[model samples]
Target chain A: MQIIIVVLLSILTILIIGLLLWKWRVRRQFRKEEQKRRLRELELTAIRSQMNPHFLFNSLNSVQNLVQQNKGREAHLYLSDFAGLIRKVLNNSEKEEVSLAEELELIRQYLNLEKLRFDFEFEVLVDETIDAHNTQVPSLLLQPFVENAIVHGLQNKRGEKHLKIDVMKKDAFVLITITDNGIGRKAAKEIQQQKNGKGTKLMKERLNILQQKQGEKYKLTTTDLEEGTLVEIVLPEEK
Target chain B: MQIKSIIVDDEKHGRENLAGLLESHCPEVILVGLANSVKSAIQLIKNEKPQLVFLDIEMPGENGFQLLEHFADINFEVIFVTAYDNYAIKAIRFSAADYILKPINFNELKTAVEKVTKRIQKKEENRQIRELNRNILQPDNPRIGLPTNDRIEFVEVKKIVHCKGESNYTHIYLHEKKHLLVAKTLVEFEDLLKEYSFVRTHKSHLVNLKHVVAYSKTDGGTLELSNSDKIFISRRRKDEVLQMLKTSIA
Candidate 1:
């Protein structure tokens, strides 16, 4: 009887210790995952903080040019329009995610500002089936790519330039496409050697963090066209 | 270099204004074709195959930009002539494309044609037009064109650290310790940049407010910029500087 009790007690103690060790390992993993998430969030904010100054200064420069040319009335009008854009950027800067409609509005304002400096045509088309006002997306997610299309793809071409943005609903995902009729990626890469552009890398990092927080796989792909470049991003809809 | 050129404008007055200016000022530009609409312009362009074109942006039916769309490959250079399109003017400037505003000034027209003549002589690649279209399409990330003696350097406006006036020239100090001496006056830069977070802290100095890291009260006043340069603040401008700093805290 004594021998049986000793064996049972030993098994019980070993089982308790084993259970405790398993629980501790699980807790450590959870803490590590939590730390990783916080780090990603911090990185996102750092990237977001580096925005808007480029557009803001260029708009001011345009106003300055108008004033220099003695177009006082035009300068005033341009300044007022610029103020509207600034307000939109400031309002959206604080948001983690914004309605699809709001994001589009911001993009429209951005394109309008760019229209002041270049003679290019652009159109933003959102599917009629998707309710833009109700849908939510990560704030300013499309900006870097749009900027990329203009800077790398279009900036060095000698002829007509066109940019188009299409946002369509694909069942559980939203498909966003940015198409530009400028110099293709191959030519652009040759011209601006070693400068693959910083926007895409930052964008990928952002999307990765979003994926970790929400267990949906986001996708981004770029294709070089004969005349220009096409970039497509697939993101999950807000549930 | 003799530039074979065409004029595309819907208005007779607009056409006359540019034609007269070219006749009086730009001896190098030879007029080859004239078109009143985008369709006619495309036809004229296809037929003449001119080396240069003076395109007016606004017109009935189709506009000047649409004419370029018809061409898959653009071989000719374009000098945009417009009345008052704030956006279009900036686009032209950003692209570094030559342009003459309506009520064309004699000196301005001469300068535009002269630039075209130089480009033609050098046989430089038509990079400006591409940049212009790109800037127009992506205005949010547009680069400002700063003219230098040898070539035009396109720099991002946010990259500029400060401007210091030196008589007829302005010394532009950029981020990454890059410096450029431009043939523009400080007053012009000040007027152009005043609204864009730049403060004229001294008679000869214009500081980009974005680069300012700290302000000091000693030695009348001083501003420490992110590039680690200390700028002197004029005694007269102290109040204005303080006010500006307070407003920019956000």
Candidate 2:
């Protein structure tokens, strides 16, 4: 009877030791996974930070020009609103994704800021057909495309510059089209041949990273329109 | 002595912050005007004619360097402010220009202001031939505008012993008793004198190869001018300076 009790006790101790070791292994794996997630978050935040300075500096330049022309009050007001918008975007930088409505609002704020510089010469047409509640986007993913349109597309042109932004739902996918009417394809081609600077290269790299994050279901396309250029992006529903 | 000053920065907060700091710390510095961009900054510098300017490096549209390009001549002192990290700080060190980092420390700010004040005083007092040499090399364009003082008249490049940039001005040490004050920075003069035998051995100091008397290696190497003044050649540029000296001598 004593021998039987000893054998039973040994079996119980072995089982407890084995269970503890298994738990330790699982916890280590969990810690590593958590660390990777944090690192990814940091990388995304860094990308967003890099984008902010380029946009902020450009807007400030506009305000400076206005102020120089003796338009101090206008410049002051524009700067105040621009700072608020920048603060809002920075506050949202930490998030993984934001609702489509919030993204659109931020884009509107950016457009308003640009409008201060361009005046009545530039126009933005937003399509109201897209559902804002259901759709989500990576924060600040769309503004750069619009900015590219203004800078590379419109800035050098003589006449009116028009930017049309369309958002629509097709089946389970959300489609966004940003088109600009400015300098023709031939001019852009000429410019491209002359210089390939850091700005365009950075934009392409950012788009690639964003595409990878959205998976194979998403698609992005850039086309040279007769009068200008168009950037189209499609995001499929998450599984 | 009251120091006339201008402030230029793209950011509203930045301009205000610098203005506030100057007001509170350096009461002797008289605020003349404030500019937010390259265009306005150029205008203010031309109009106000300040003796000193606190300038920001990076601005929207055209940067601080672009502002320098607009003036065929500059008569003001500039202290650059940058938000860049250590590598950029080192680059400024290599250029021998004074700059303050962002989140400005009050003590450091005070020291920079004091340095400029002392330089101004030295210029006014008519002492220090080295400082006078620095003024002769101050013209942004060596060929066009060379600043001259009553004591030291502007001499041709052939008569110059060495040229150095102090703040916004260049001092040209001449063979004659007098030195010339050129109202331009070092980088400006560097571009203008590229064709001449003037070689920049250090960030702050440029020497005429025709005036170099002896060259010896110490802490990398040192160049002794005809005036018996020894100027240290930077470690990075030692080889280049040596080669230039050899070829010029030959």
Candidate 3:
């Protein structure tokens, strides 16, 4: 009986050791995988930043044309705005989060410069209920959508082309809506160059990464208005 | 031969501006007529049948796009005059239609006139207009106008099974045992085809989710397509590929 009890104790000790060893290996593997995943996300972010073509060159081209046409004052006015936008973009780097006000200012600068060149009318409306100062979002998140609205929706419009952007707070979410009375997605797809899809795809992945990090919902929807297009971006409201 | 052209814009200033630009810059383009409204423009187009029309969008009652729908046999090519509106440019781009931006620059105007003439010389009839009309009327699953070295080929977006990158070019493999070598990069196809159930499964390949038959996760992952072609999915895009495949099936 003594021998049998000793043998049983030995078996139990081995089993405990085995179980601990197994658990340790699993945790180590999981950590390694997590490290790899984080690295990949960082890599993706760099690629996205690189993929954004230089809109500055085109704006400068317009400015150059203005200067050549002897519209010195007009060129000067637009150049200041363009310079501000470039500075904001450079300043926007290295930060993970930015205030809604700062983001809007950047967008405003972009739109202003574009308006100077393209002559499209625009309005940026922030709802009175929400505090724009305290709200924080992923830096450069909304710019791509705005760019899409301009490139795909408003660029082809005739008459006095009007653009309306509304930022409001819904329950637990901040809603951003950009509307333009221009051609819709259907038309954009038809003349779609090869580079267009890849840009948006990268843009979507970036938004997904932000959503995953915040453990909140991120939704983007593009709807066609009768004469234009409306794009809505829903981001989680978190401190 | 001098190309007879007409200017159509509700704004009297728009018609006058384009007419003046053509007169000054593009000596080869003669402004034959000018109309302020679609109703008058339609009558004028029928009467004059000018080789080209500088069409303006967003008039009082009917827009510029509505003008094309009026005629069954549109003979003239349209050079769209637009502002900074995005949708119109995209649609115009999608239709492979031609247009110039607002505050039109002189160089762009000269280029447009030159390009229209060259295009006319290349083909007697403007097939691009018909193609554009078809694309506008049917928005989804469009025949994407791909301009190859020789001619423009409109391929249905869904029929494409997969695309493989060959350095600077892309090989578009169709379902019916056919392939097209396009001068564009795979990145370009990714931009256009991603909306049509295509995902970048590998660095060198963009596969249509609709074509995926099986996905094997073990041994660095492999997907079996409906075309009997097996593709490698990188570990980086594995999760996204799975999610897209799941959603596509559902």
User: Which TM-score values does chain B get in all models?
Assistant: 0.84, 0.50, 0.82
For candidate 3 chain B, the 10 contiguous residues with the lowest summed lDDT are B84-93
For model 3 chain A, give the 10-residue run with minimal summed lDDT: A43-52
**Model 2: per-residue lDDT, tens digit, A108-155?**
777778777665244444446554633456666676677677666776
Clashes of each: 5, 19, 21
> Native contacts retained per candidate?
0.00, 0.00, 0.00
RMSD of each: 22.6, 24.2, 18.0
The digit string of per-residue lDDT tens for model 2 on B73-116 reads 55566677876543334334323445776655555678888877
lDDT of 3 by residue, A100-119 (tens): 77778878988887776567
Better of 2 and 3 by DockQ: 3
What is each predicted model's overall lDDT from 0 to 1? 0.76, 0.67, 0.76
DockQ comparison, 1 vs 3, better candidate: 3
Model 1's DockQ score = 0.01
Candidate 1, residues B13-127: lDDT per residue as tens digits? 8888678768767878899988999989988988899999999998899877667767767788888888766556656665566887665656667787787777778888666
Q: What residue pairs clash in candidate 1, if any at all? A: A114-B139, A116-B87, A117-B91, A118-B136, A157-B130
- DockQ of each candidate relative to the true complex: 0.01, 0.01, 0.03
Flag regions of model 3 displaced more than 4 Å. Answer: A1-239, B103-107, B165-168, B185-188, B202-204
